[model samples]
Target: MSGKYIIMFKDSATPEQIQKYAQDVSSNGGAVHQVYDASIKGFSASIPDAYFQQLQSSLTDSPIAVIEPDGVVTTQ
Candidate 1:
């Protein structure tokens, strides 16, 4: 089972750091969907259930800020 996630980075995170993180996610069998560098610093990715825990742990231990489910958000 794979789920989408919003991996937020610190406002001060460098582009290199973000890119590296994205690469790490891909290496872990995840797929990056979007990357925001201005105003918001983060990337949206689809991560496999198997590597989800490891991803959370890695992010928690890194300079990243937060991680949350990228649940569908629709405006009526």
Candidate 2:
């Protein structure tokens, strides 16, 4: 499933630190599809909810939240 996510890492984080976040997600069963980003806005690739929640407190800056392409929702 395609999704639009906003991932803002800790501004205080170093390049290695940020890269570690991405690696962590992939290692933890989260598949990062793409890091959709532009000059104006910043966002990360598509990862599972597990990945999103994992990088919460670690982010010294604003937390990254998945805005679109939400998790699989069942409608009955």
Residue-wise C-alpha lDDT for candidate 2, range 16-72, written one tens digit per residue: 654666676668666555554343233456666665565554454543332344345
Instruction: Name the best candidate (by TM-score).
Output: 1
Candidate 2 global lDDT? 0.51
Instruction: State how far residue 37 of model 2 sits from its true place (Å).
Output: 9.6
RMSD values for the candidates in order, in angstroms, are 1.7, 6.8
| lDDT on C-alpha atoms for all candidate structures | 0.86, 0.51
Candidate 1 segments whose C-alpha is farther than 4 A from its true place: none
Q: Which stretches of candidate 2 lie over 4 Å from their true place?
A: 1-4, 33-43, 57-76
Instruction: Write the residue-wise lDDT of candidate 1 on 1-76 in tens digits.
Output: 7899998888778889889889987898899999987778999999888787886778656768998999879999
Global lDDT of model 1: 0.86
